[model samples]
Structure formats: structure tokens, C-alpha cells
Target: MNKNIDNFVPAEEPSKDQPITVLMIEAVGKCNAICGYCPRGQGLLGPETNTYITMDLLDKALDLASSGSNHAIYLHHRGEPFLHPKLDEIIRRVREKGFYTFLSTNLISATPDKVKKVLTAGINQIEMHYSAGLTRLPHEVLLKRIHEIRKLNWELRNFGCRLEMNFSLFGETREIIMEELSRHTYYDETLYVRWFEPHDWPSLEKIIDRGVDYRDCHWYKHKACAILSNGDIVICCLDQFSHSCRTNIKDIDRIDWESLADRRMCQGCTQHVEMNWLEEDAIDMPLWLTRKQEIDTWTA
Candidate 1:
């Protein structure tokens, strides 16, 4: 029984009538924090990695993506995107191409001047990942940073942009997190609580014990492409974690989508299974509860 899962063939590509709605660009691969649940923080990624995307390559990616119809461009993947010196320029370029721009950060680098620059750059949305479970900052410190960011947003008249806080829920801290969420109210702002995925993290056992499953994930079915900082392209953002799924951005035009669908990695990923389940109304519970249930067994 040669049951090595990695050797499984890819599945057939489904029909894709719509243009890519999301284009995720990895602007940088370096970060200031070492969260317990992140692969980068665990030192799984090498130090020699290209820390930032080059301007020339960014231009090419933007040109290629803009040539088609893209709804939004997310300028992050696995690192502190603010570390990129030309982040403002990147956002401005995306806006010039007539696509909404989004960036997620820990807010450690969100100085008042930098916040002003980001707003002036016309970024359409910003997500602040301020979870105590995922960062070194204490809960109170993170909340203070969030307040400061909200203050900055208010000072800029809300910048006509969307601001969101992404909190990763843990069993031990869930109640406290809920209380914190209740205490904070921002006009027109959104809040999200996400399950912490223990990808290559030391806390895999703890997270798995808390009822997380990684099987039959269908996020690849979504119409989106990820461009890594080094100009490599992957069908899914999680695919970047596995080298087997990566293809050069230049070869994107020649990629065989059907074959890509059949990759063993794609077949085994459960990254966005909850989103897929939600699409089908198969899981009737609230989004958070639906995700909390183990993926091996869940139905509408």
C-alpha cells in the first residue's frame, strides 16, 4: 500500500468563466514579530529569502494583472508589508490601474506619519491583525494600538476606506476576546475572528486538539492568484508554503489549469474548506461555529 499522499495526481480544473477577483501580491517576506503559530516566526523559512519585491517585478505583475479584470489587489501574504520601503508607491500604482488596494499589518510600524502616507496613497482597505494569541504583544498593548489606529482613522475623516481587525480565537482566550470586541466600536469598521491554523508551527498539537482539521480544502476553486515577492505564482495562497505548487509568474500564461487542479497538495488542503461549505449552505451554523467544527465531518 503505497499511500504516500503527496504523490496523488491533481484533479480536473473546473470551468472558470469569471475573471480573477483577487490578486494577492506578496510585497515582503520579512517581519518584525515572531508569532508562535506562523511558519516564518518558527524559522521554517530561510534567512536568505528575498525580503522585498523589486519595483521592476512589481510593475510587471501590476501590468499583467491590470491587463485583465481584477477587482482588488491584496499587498501581503506572510510578512510585515510595511517593511517594504515603497509600499506607498505600490498602493498608488494599483489605484492608478483602477483596482482597489488592501494591506494587512500588525500596526507596530504604524507611526502617525506612516498612517498619513498610507491614507494619502489611496489604499482602499486596511486589516490590522491584533490578536494576542498570534503576536508577542499583550492584550492590553494590542488594544491600545488598535485604539491609536482608530484614532488615526478618525483624524483622517476615516479616509473613505475600510478598516478591519482580524482576531485569531483560542479556547483559553475566547471569552476575553469577545469582551474586548464588545468594548470597541468603530463607525463603519468591521471585525473578524479567525481560527488559527498551525501550519508548520510548534503549536500544531494544541491547535489540532482544539478541533481544527486540514482536509478536503477547496479554496483553490476560488478564482484568485498569488504573486510571491520573488515573482513566483501559485494558484492558492497556502500553496506558497509548499514549493511543489509554485510556478514562475512568467509562465502563468502557459499554465495548464486542469493539471494544476490535480496537484496532490491542492487535493489535501483544507485551508478554505469553511468558505466552500458556506457557499453551499451545507453548514447551517454561524460562520465562526462552522469553522470551529472539525473539517472531517460537517454538513449543511
Candidate 2:
């Protein structure tokens, strides 16, 4: 008798009538850092094996832009996005189509000059990933770079943009870091902490019953569509949806969402370690206790 549990699949809903607003564009194939937990981390899959989505692929995504309410594009999907030389050109093209755009940069190689360039090119928001206060500089020299960029003259602020920090917590003193952040007074800036969940080993039972709330942050699940460089459209980034959740753009006008969602493309997909899936009221214990246990489980 086969006793292996099948993959976790979310409840299906009605098909979408319009295009999802947010689209994740993977612009580059290489990264400057070598984090241990990254998909392109220092293991079987490194920068050598990574491939980037080209301008032609992005053109297709623009053609398929959601004709819905407000269309927003998020750069930096798979690897570090700064590696793309034509990043500014890409942004210009997106804006030319009259769509709002944002970029999630790791801030490793992002210099003040590059920051200014993107801001000038018209970036509405920048979602920066910071590992830790100052100690995690090995992940990338972002902490130092961010400090310098924030101090730019008032002219830089006029680009009309907001900066948000997103940190990945593995094993750290949350209170201490939070206090440090408070002391810095990021000037009412938002700080988001993402819990680490390994893709190779997903906690199914725990995640479903007492884990983080994956549904909350998942805007893509509700509407957005992700276009890979190969012209394959993915529903979400985590599910490894090479099977059915993805559809090739041979005929963009004739996409059949009914059959795509029903396919086993994302059968056993669950949230990642850095992604918090539980809401405050949904968990049994306080936020700290639950988050601590999540870290412990990953560490163990």
C-alpha cells in the first residue's frame, strides 16, 4: 500500500474574467550573493545554470497586461534583478504603456547612482531585502548601501517614491533587531519580515493547521499572471508549475483558464520558509512564540 501523502492543493474558485494587476517579471539570470537557502544558492543550481527572461518575453507580457483597474509590474522575480543591463529600458517601456511599476531589489550591488537612475526612470516603489542590521552584510553589502542612499540630497526624494524594507528571518533575535530598527527611525518606513520555509521540505500538516497565512500576501493567486522568458505563464512563483498551472502564449487571445487551474500544475505547493502564512488570530500562541517555533523547525 502506498502511504505517501499527496501534494496540498488549495480549494478551487471561479475563473477570472480579467487580467491580474500585478505581474512579476524575472529580468536577470545571475545574482551577486550566495545565500545558503536561495534556489540559486551555493548548491546544484548556481548562477551558471540560471537563465534570464529577455526583452522579447517582456514585450509579450506587456501585450497581455491586465486591462483591469490599475496595472502594476514588479521587477526582480527569480534572481537578483540588478544584473540586467537593460533594466532602465525595461522600466521605460512599461511606463510608456501607462502602467505603474515597482522593483524588489536585494540592494547588494545597487549603488546610489543606480538608485538615482531607476528613480529617474520612474519607479513608484522599491521593496528592498535586508538580511540583518549590519551583521548580515555577507549576504550583500546592502545595509551600508541603503544607509547612504537614504541620505541623498532632497533632490533624490523628489523622484516621488517610497522605500520599504523586507527582511528574511532564519535564526535571529527579533526583539533586538526590531529595537535596532526602531532606534534608526527609518522615518515611518515599513519593515516586513519573511519567514524561511525550504522548498525541498514543505511542512504540510503544520502549515495547514497552525502555520502562517499563505492566502493573505498572495495577490497573484487572486488575479495576477507571471510571464517567464520562455513565454510560459505561471500562476504563482512557488508551486513549480511547469505542469498545468502554466500555459504557453501561442495564442494569447485563446487562453483557457478553465482547464489550466484544474491541471495538477501546482498540486503539492506550499509556502516558503520566509513567507508567513498565518494570521495573528489564526495561530494558537502569540506572534513571537509561533515565529520562534517556525525558526526552530527550520534550524532543526
Off by over 4 Å in 2: 1-13, 20-22, 42-49, 68-70, 132-141, 157-159, 178-221, 240-245, 250-255, 258-266, 272-300
Candidate 1: minimum summed lDDT over ten consecutive residues — where? 291-300
TM-score for each candidate, following the candidate numbering: 0.71, 0.66
Candidate 1: Cα lDDT at 260? 42
Winner by lDDT? 1
lDDT of 2 by residue, 1-300 (tens): 111236625435434565443356667655666555454444434334356667877777776664533445666655666667777777777767766566777777677877766666666567676752232354224555666555542365442455667665556566765666555434233434544333442222122334334333343344544555455555545432233333565446544453234323333444433333211211122344334333321110
Which pairs in model 1 have colliding backbones? Answer: 10-262, 10-263, 11-262, 217-270, 282-299, 282-300, 283-300
- What's the C-alpha lDDT at position 86 in model 1? 86
Give lDDT per model, in order.
Answer: 0.58, 0.51
